[model samples]
Target: MAFLIKRGSKKYPYITARVRAMKSKLMPREVYPKLMNMDIPEITRLMGESEYKQDVDELAQKYSGLDLLEHALNQNLARTYRKLLRISKDEPNYLITEYLRHWDIWNIKTILRGKYYGAPAQEIMDAVVAAGQLGYRQITSIANMESIEDIKSALANSPYYSAIADYEGGELSTIENELDKIYYSRLLASIGKSKGEKLSLKFIMTEIDLKNLKTLFRTKKAGLDKDVILELLIPGGMELKSRDLKKMSSLSWSDFLKRLEDYSYWSAISEVVSEDMTSLMDVEAVLDKYAIEYASKVSHYYPISILPIYDYMLRKNNEINSIRTIVRGKKVNLPDEIIRKHLVM
Candidate 1:
């Protein structure tokens, strides 16, 4: 694996060529306009004839309509991500796999929340994406556990167990925060030595900064104290320091806007604070757009690196999310303008 990874730079021309080919197959912006006019079954049929064909066909027997769409999307994402891992066998593969660990965090949170909400075990299992190191059987077992404590015990042997176990009380917020911290900590830990991997490190750090900023902004909007906000804020952002976040957390809304004025994130932060955008939803929209733009720029400069793969993955995920949003919005009879606003395009 190390040998293959070390040779990746030389092999990069080939790898990047393949990635570009795959990237070109992605649904274009024009497709969405036509898709918006189609019914659910028509949409499924359209997808069946496209890149999602095999997944759609395989899942056709068991699921239909939205369930089918969701399952196909999940399977496609998992398959594509796993293929990336298989192709790039060394450091690049390791870095990509580490990033995919977010799915592990996602799976854990889904199981915990499903248990908390008393969802059916099968339903919880259906919702999980088995793209991480955790096997499907382990996730199924976790889902089958009768109580949250039993689920926590199942996770006890995993890296997230210790952080999650410390929150003995049944506060979902505490458990969730611990999970967030563990995810980000693991991300930084996986970076290891960063001397030659500045592009990868910068991309990951920028993501962390955006995530922390979103969390802090939400906490402030909710009138939560600095300590509470810090509890959820991951510590490894590149540009935003803990002390700076602490200071921002302590400010009044106006003061917070002032503090962010000189920062790179000033424009977005100002929009949220000055416009009194009470909802974190809009703030999150801007963050996603900003992150995508930043990742796109990084990938353009470092095409041979993992940046392109990361950018493609992010964009693909965004595309799936946009589709899901459109389907749900249509189902709810939301105006097209409102739905467009909800989209991250």
Candidate 2:
């Protein structure tokens, strides 16, 4: 997306105000409790009557049931982010776009998975969001390609190429992890370009920390070697160092929880950890709650800056994810309690 304003321009106040107004229109937190009790058709009908109506209406002709809801959620996410990109200018524009490029990393991973699994090109294409720096043409080109190697070749000139180059012909997981590293590195580098962007940087670092912690817990449970776990850890986390993670990976699960109890995350995580060992999803729930709370705090702390827009984007995405969970759960005829448990809200 092109910037609407040139260098030396400062449009943060206007853009922040607009994003705040948009945030106000988000699906209220109280609505989800009621939605969890609804069936698939009821959920779909509720969505149709809300802000998602346009996307639902547009896709309803070609798709039905959960498939339709899925398509509409994806569409609305891309459309909302696209609007943000369109209205933003200068530093605000650059920072917002940089944050959204995480989806590019996501799209690449999806393509690789599809290629390895021999999924149809259309199926692969349908999974793409096109919300990142890569345009529709580039995403379509990658999705249309027959193999992961071919997708790599198509992206050879981009920075993403470097992430895959060293791991060419390696295990798919290796390549995927490399992409994760590259995405975080680029995120930090972009934050560096914008002076006094502390809140944004903090949020990004918090995300990296959560990701690393999740990986650590998973690897520990899998009984992976400390060296292998260390190798897999991404750098630049605010709380946990690579060395600390290496040690934690080697510790017993109980010991690991003991260590976590000494940190800020303990309050949220302690409830889930026990002798039987908590599920990975439980740990993730704590992290997700902390992240949302952190973003909310940041937005209020810096009302007339890019922080609010970033917060809005995160909240909006969470809402989309919650709705998707409800749709998927209802489609499977899952219990309402089980469906509600999956929602972030």
Candidate 3:
């Protein structure tokens, strides 16, 4: 749910057109296949020729190989998201910003994980995507913290303060879960009661459902207790209700898999299950692929709405991941086929 107050003004036409244009300029599908066949330097050269050329060139002086590529991709993603935020206004602004809070979750999670492991501030900062409400300064401040307690103190005034407060010095996964639940609950609450926000609502719920599915699957694989798993599942998903998750958590993995066949993700889940019912990687790959296809479908179905903006953001994120996979795979001399399997597209 987003807390966007509509001003009785409409500017979707302008924003939609701009987003569509941006979508068109994204690297075409064929480019991925070509990049898969390239060596690390060749992939770098290719990025140097693409829209990320500026980032590649600027970062090239300080880093090389996969490191350079990853840093460049992070910078490029942040830049693109900021540009989208700048273009947004009214309802679109609210919708896009709500979606972008994803980065806030990402930044906070990165900070927490880094602190948990005692990672260097620069290493944590490298992973921070300053595309959310939290700017680079705020994220940097959090990253510089010496401990989880210090990080929580820095975010004490934010929405995550209460969530982080309860989990101070607690398990990383618990803190991450609290952050997610808080983000989604507040988002839905902010959307309030409005027919106009229907599409955005559906979109967020779909995202939540997918995430819950992943979490449930992982927990089941780990042999976690039914009640523990149930406690971790997020509410407000489109199809997966609390009662449904609780029931699923109580069942065996095989029974849980059978139950999943009743949902929209059944087709995608079935493909991976058929391939290797025990392979988490295969299951995750199918899930990510379905997410891309679903987002694409939603974007096209509501071309003039705020969906395309979200669609662009997801696709851009996938691109960054794809590029990182390609570069990292090439650096390790992994086969193109294996590299392709790791990609979302």
lDDT of 1 by residue, 97-203 (tens): 88888888889988878877878997887678877768778888888888767877888788888767765545588877787888878877778664325677878
TM-score of candidate 1 relative to the true fold: 0.92
Q: On a 0 to 100 scale, what is the lDDT of residue 304 in model 2?
A: 74
Q: What TM-score, computed on C-alpha atoms, does each candidate reach?
A: 0.92, 0.92, 0.93
- Tens-digit per-residue lDDT, 1-345, candidate 2: 246553333688889889989989999989988887777778888889999999999999999887788888888988899899999887889889889988888888888888778889878877777788887788888899875578778889877888776544435888888888998898888785453366678878878888888887788788788778887889888787666776787888778877887667678777876757756777777778778888889789877777888889989999988988877877778888777777787
Checking candidate 1 for backbone clashes, the offending pairs are none
- What's the lDDT for all of these models? 0.80, 0.81, 0.84
lDDT of 2 at 268: 72
Each prediction's total of clashing residue pairs, residues at least 3 apart in sequence or on different chains, is: 0, 0, 4
For candidate 3, lDDT tens digit of each residue in 138-174? 8888788787777777887888888788765647887
User: Best-fitting candidate, measured by lDDT?
Assistant: 3
Clashing pairs in 2: none
Q: Mind sharing the TM-score for model 2?
A: 0.92
User: Residue 204 error for model 2, in Å?
Assistant: 1.0
The runs of at least 3 residues in candidate 2 whose Cα sits more than 4 Å from the true structure, single-residue gaps closed, are 1-9, 166-170, 193-196
Question: Using lDDT as the measure, what is the rank order of every candidate, best first?
Answer: 3, 2, 1
Q: Is 2 or 3 the stronger prediction by TM-score?
A: 3
Q: Candidate 3, overall lDDT? A: 0.84
